[model samples]
Target: MPAEEGSGIHCRLDELLADRGMTLTELSRRVGVSLVNLSVLKNDRAKAIRFSTLTAVCEVLGCEVGDLLTVARRP
Candidate 1:
């Protein structure tokens, strides 16, 4: 079924980082993003993400956009 409108959009950054044995600090440094910004994205508190930011993250993490983000269906 299609996810309902307003359903939560989640980030899998923590899981991806864990799988790669990488830390947020390391990723922040590699992606040239601030820890605060990465933390917001990792915690799914970010309302939007730039394509450049996404591309940088994907390059460092060896993942696609879909691997980093997901939508959680409303219960």
Candidate 2:
């Protein structure tokens, strides 16, 4: 299903993973996040993210929080 319009924050996980030549499965293993959860974030279906999970992902991807997430404005 498509993400709801202006419903949640945008996650750049797919782009960052591609730029680093990493797959979602690889990231899931490295960051200790479940593939399903990661997929949710990757597809912009997540309503919230834990700080620890965010930190782990950022550490593995060599990116800051801003690099992984962005605010999507409602029209």
Candidate 3:
């Protein structure tokens, strides 16, 4: 089934960071984003993200946008 708008999107920030042996503070510093703001996105509580932020994060993490956000399929 098709996911409702703004639903079923999952953030993989924590997992990606773990896989890379990186900390939230490190990412915050590298991406030039505040820890609190990155925490919101890390915990999947962010309602939206800016394109600039996304690009910065992807660059720091060496990942594509798809690696950061993914669509979860519902049965």
Candidate 4:
């Protein structure tokens, strides 16, 4: 489903990964998630993510959930 009409869902995963000089493949390797699966999340194509997966990604990337995603009023 599309993001809610006014939820303003957005993602910063790619930007943060770039800032850390980490590539998708690298993140996949470290986080034990498939590159294809990570791509889904990175590209905002994923409908949902397991809490364990999210936690593992955060641990590997040294980031919080808030750093990877954001919700704001849709302009």
Candidate 5:
């Protein structure tokens, strides 16, 4: 069955960064987030995202949230 909205959704922050040839270090520097905190987002372990952090990421990467995330299948 298909996943429900926000149920099995996944973030693609790491993938988008990679596709753009950006390192997590560079993104952390640009986004004003610590490497460790950003790693949580990058590794898809973040329970939620702050609006400020989301804005920072959008600013740095020039992408809307939709461009960096997708709904994933549930197990």
Candidate 6:
């Protein structure tokens, strides 16, 4: 599914992983999150994320929260 209409937050998981030559499966394993949950976040289908989950992902990706998510402008 596409991102929620009017929802401004954009997840940068796809770009970050791609830039680091990492796959979602590898990230999921490293971050201790299930592939399906990671996929939901990666696809921008997740409405919210737990802080622990966010921290884990950021740690594994070597990024800050701002690098993982952004405020997207609505067109």
Tens-place lDDT digits, model 2, residues 8-57: 57889999999999999999999999999999999988877899999999
How accurate locally is residue 41 in candidate 2, as Cα lDDT from 0 to 100?
91
Which pairs, if any, clash in model 5? none
TM-score of 6: 0.91
Clashing pairs in 2: none
> Model 5 segments beyond 4 Å from truth?
1-7
- Local distance difference test, candidate 6: 0.89
| Top candidate, metric lDDT | 2
What lDDT score is found at residue 10 in candidate 2? 84
- The TM-score that candidate 2 achieves is 0.87
Residue pair clashes in candidate 1: none
Model 3 C-alpha lDDT per residue in residues 14-68, reported as the tens digit of each score: 9999999999999999999999999988876777899999999999999999999
lDDT string for model 5 (7-73, tens) is 4557788888988899999999988999999887766666778999988998899899888767676
lDDT of each: 0.89, 0.90, 0.89, 0.80, 0.80, 0.89
Q: lDDT by residue for model 4 over 1-75, one digit each (tens)? A: 126633355667799899999999998998899999988777666777899998999898888999987774443
Model 6 lowest lDDT segment of ten:
1-10
Q: Give the residue spans of candidate 6 off by over 4 A.
A: 1-3
| Model 4 deviation from native, Cα RMSD in Å | 2.6
lDDT of 2 at 33: 96
Model 4: lDDT to the true structure: 0.80
Q: Is candidate 4 or candidate 6 better by TM-score?
A: 6
| Per-residue error (Å), model 4, residue 50 | 0.3
Candidate 6: lDDT of 2? 37
